[model samples]
Target: MKLYKVDAIVLRSREMRDADRILTLLSRQKGKIKAVAHGVNKPSSRKRGAVQPFCYSSFLLYRGRELDSVNQCEGIEAFSGLRADLDRISYASYLAELTDSASMEDQIDGEAFFLLLTILHLISRDGADVELLTRSFEIRLLDIAGLRPHLDNCVGCGVPVESETVGFSSSTGGVVCGRCSGIAGDVKFFPRGTVEILKLLLKWDLKKTERIKVPPRVRQQLRQIMQNYISYHLEKKLATALFLEKLYYHY
Candidate 1:
């Protein structure tokens, strides 16, 4: 059996055979891996804590004909702050799910790994606003994954947008000029501020976006727009996102 190591973050774990678990991990080198961790659920298990969702750890794995097996592991950053706060944990779960959904086994995605680690680092700290950081993360993730929205030009007409306000066409994959706005099924006009923030967030990291105070109205608009964009691309609603919305919006 061939043995190797992966620096990975645990995406999820499901119980199996009483004490073992099947783990979904997003690895720095392997992209995504499904590995079996034997005895992880037992009372005296050492890998129990390190195999849970959202744990960043180094995994010792052995190649198997069926699937990889976790030989041993050690925790790096458990994101302990996220565990104590319900809201932060919810958002962090969304990130983990998104990464799992977007990633593929044996496909190296350095950008996605770094972007996810960066967001987790920010969310685990105290200086960042969770909402803004989440929004920024959404934009940056898409950007790194090559799904970034076109902000400066029209998706339909191929013209430089000159309007102070414009409609975003999710179906068209970008902002639409007024002349091209009426043709898309999911087109909706956004005010100038919303458009500006959307443009700004695409290139900004957590450090650069941490201090910008977005007004409540614009923040809500950004969230709605991002949700729409994600739904259009990913074709599924994020459950943790809905939970986060309910926690914040009294829904």
Candidate 2:
């Protein structure tokens, strides 16, 4: 069998028979890959820490008939800081889960992979508001996935949406003007500022993101809108998302 080496981020892991694990990883060149790490769960195993969820590691994968086997792994950035706190850990899991759900095998998404690594690094080093970071990640993920909403113009009519109250059409993939919203069923209305905040979050980097503040109400609204958008496009609920929300709000 051929051996391949690449930089990868551990997206998720499931226990195998005993000490082994099935890892879902996102690699720089390979996109998403499912590999089994033999004997990784043992206390004395060298690969124990390397295969943990949210870890960025350099891996040597041996090709297998179905799934590749992770022969060797060396930690690049374990992102230990994210695991230091429950909130951070939960948020990191949410990001990893989203990436895993959105990505496909054999499709190289270098930009998305880099963005995920950068966001994890940022969360590890400089602490961010969990809510803001999660929302920002969701927006950026949608943008990267080519599902970014049309905030500047109406989805139905080709007019600039300048109304105080704007409506979003999940089916149409963006905001529709008050006039055009009537045609779309179950259209949700948002204050103009809310849409602007969503746009700003989409446009700015995490460093500059702190400059804008979203009120709790608006934040909640944006979260719901993003959740709807993601669910619509991905056509499934993110299992980790609810857990993160509960963890974030409960403690």
Candidate 3:
């Protein structure tokens, strides 16, 4: 077997028989990898805390025909703050789930990996608004996936969309002017301010995001729009997303 090393973020993990764990990692050089960590669950295991979810580590893996085996993993950053808070942990799970769903094995995406790590770090340390962060992540994820909707001009007319009431076409990939929106019966109208908010999210970095004030109602609307858009693109509802939504409402 050949040995390799890569920087990875733990996307998910499942317990195996005895003290082993099967980890689904999103790697910087390799898009996604499944590896077995023997004895990780044991109290004396050296890899105990290093293999936890949301952790960024440098892993030495031995390639196998069935699945890779983790020879060694040295913790780089555990993102401890995320694990300390329930809300942050839930949000991080949602982000990880989306990344895992969007990626394929053997594909390298350093940009996406960097984005996920940066967002995770922000959520961990910054007392940022979870809803806004979630929405921003959704938009940015779509943008990275090349699924970002057209916002500057009407999807149909190619004219600049300047109306206070704008129609968003998930199918068309952006805003459509009223004149052109009639062709799509399912298109939803959004306040211009909501449109502006979405644009701000797309343009700003995670740290600058806190400066923008979004009203509760506007935030709710944006949330619905992003959730619907993401679901339509992914073609399935995310389990972690549903859990996060429930947590949001319960708290």
Candidate 4:
């Protein structure tokens, strides 16, 4: 058996037979790995906290023909802030799921790994704006996946979008001008302010997002547009996203 060490974030963990757990990890060394941690599900298991979702941990794994096995592990950051609150947990879960969707097995994406790690750290802190941070994560994640939607010019007409109102096409992955709105029936309209903020979200530093306070209307529009855009590319709605929606509706 070949042994290797990796520092990783647990993206997902599912219980297995007799205290075992199947873990999906996004590691610094290897992009995405599926491994099993024996006895981690048991109450007496020392590795319990380290194997949970959104945990950043260091693991010594034995490579097998089918799947890797966790031989030893230690928790680096359990993100207690995320675990302690339902809202934070939902947001963190969305980020984890998005990262898993964007990553590929055995392909190292240093930028993505660090982006997620940084965002996780930010969202885990006190008084963090989890919703805004999540939006930033969504846009950045799409860019890293090479699915960034064009915010500058019209995707259909090839002209600059200077109007007060513009349409967004998830299928085309960009904004559409009034003249090009006929290109798709699903094009959603956005105010120029919302569009500008979306552009800023793409270009601005993630940490500095707190300075820009968005109006409630614009925020709702931005959320809907990003959700639609992400869902189109991923070809399915994220479970965490739906949960968050219901979570939002209740509050």
Candidate 5:
């Protein structure tokens, strides 16, 4: 069997046959790939820590026709903070799933690889704004996947929407001018500043997100807009997203 090495983050780990796991990994070199971790479920397996979801590790894999197999692995960072808190874990899982959903197998997405790595580090730190970070991730990931919403100009009329209020259409993929709002279905109207904030979230440095102060109302609006926008493009509600929603409402 041919062998290859890659540094990757475990996006998901699913139970397979006894003492084995099927892992979805996002690698810097190879994008997304699935592989089996034989015996990683056993109490004595050394790969246990490295194979868990959200662990960044170096993996030695034997290439198989259908799927790769983990030969040896070592954990680089366990992101222990995420595991320690329910909120962090939920948001982190959503991020991982979003990354996995947007990425294609064997396609090199260096940008997304680094984006997820950065987000994992940010969320793992104390006092991190997980909600804000997640909103940023959603917009940025959509952009990375070439599904960026039209923010600067109205999606329907091509007119720059500079009014205090504008309509956003998830189906139309961006903000709409007042005159064009009637053509879109399920339009949500909010302050134009909210649209500007979305633009900033897409272009601003992720590390500097803490500096921006968004009002509670704007935050809520952003969340709703992004949630709808992402679901429309992906064509399905993400499982982690549904779980996070329940977690939030239950609290």
Candidate 6:
């Protein structure tokens, strides 16, 4: 077995037999890896702090033929603020879920790795807007995964969308002009406000999203657009969405 080192963030973890845990990690060197961090559930285990979800750490791993084993881990950053609030946790879980679903095994996405790290840092800080961070991460991750939605001209008729309203076509995988929108069954229109937001999100870096203000109506519009865009591509329900619904809209 080859011993290798990687810097990664624990995305998710589930308890296993004998106080061990199976970790889903997004590694900087190796992309995504699942390794058994043995004995983490035990109180005396040194790996306890570093193996929890959202913990960023450097790991020494023993690479086997099929699955790897975590030999040692050194703690880096644990965003404890997520533990202090339900809303932050909800957004963090959604971010983790989206990253986990989009990532592939052994594909090194250094951009994506650092993107998650940056967002985690933003989430940990005081006065961070959860919606803004979440939306920024969503758009950036979509870009890294090569699922970037076209925000330039119309995807259908190749005309510039100069109207006050436009349609987002998941079928065309971008914006559709008003004239060609009705030709597709999956087109959804958004106002000029949401259209501008999409354009800004597509072009802005995540670090520049701090002072950006989005109204409640714009937030709702962006959420629906993101939901439709993701659902059109993934075609499956994200497990964290249910939790988010329970926390925010439901009692």
Q: Evaluate candidate 4 by giving its C-alpha RMSD to the native, one decimal.
A: 1.4
Q: What TM-score should be assigned to candidate 5?
A: 0.97
Backbone clashes per model, in order?
0, 0, 3, 0, 0, 0
Candidate 4 wrong stretches, greater than 4 Å: none
When summed lDDT is taken over every stretch of 10 residues in candidate 5, the lowest stretch is 242-251
TM-score pick, better of 3 and 4: 4
Q: Residue-wise lDDT of candidate 3 within 1-251, one digit each (tens)?
A: 39999999999989987899999998998878999999999999999888999999999999999999999999999988888788889889999999888887778888788888888878887567766877888888788878887889998989999999999977667789989988676699999989889998987878777888988889877977787777878889999989977877542
Give the winner by lDDT: 3 or 4. Answer: 4
Question: Which candidate has the top score in lDDT?
Answer: 5
For residues 1-251, write the lDDT of model 4, one tens digit per residue. 39999999999999878899999999999889999999987899999989989999999999999989999999999888888888889899999998898788899887888999999999888888888888888898889889999998999979999999989999988999999998988898889989899888887888877777988788889899999998888999989889889889443
Candidate 6 worst ten-residue window by lDDT:
242-251
Deviating ranges (above 4 Å) for candidate 5: 249-251
Q: For residue 38, what is the lDDT in candidate 4?
A: 94
TM-scores of the candidates are 0.95, 0.95, 0.94, 0.97, 0.97, 0.95
Query: So what's the TM-score on candidate 1?
Result: 0.95
- Cα-based lDDT for every prediction: 0.85, 0.87, 0.86, 0.90, 0.91, 0.86
Q: Which prediction has more favorable lDDT, 3 or 5? A: 5
- Quote the lDDT for 202 in model 5: 83
Preferred candidate (lDDT higher): 1 or 4: 4
- Per-residue lDDT of 221-249 in model 6, one digit per residue for the tens? 88778877887787776889767766664
What lDDT tens digits, residue by residue, belong to model 1 across residues 1-251? 38999999998888878999999988898888999999998989988889988999999999998889999999998999999988788889988887887677888887888888888888888866888888888888788777888888898878988787888987778899988878788899988779888878776656767768799899988988888888788888878777777888751
How many clashes does the backbone of model 5 have?
A: 0
TM-score of 3: 0.94
**Ten residues in a row with the worst lDDT in model 3?**
242-251
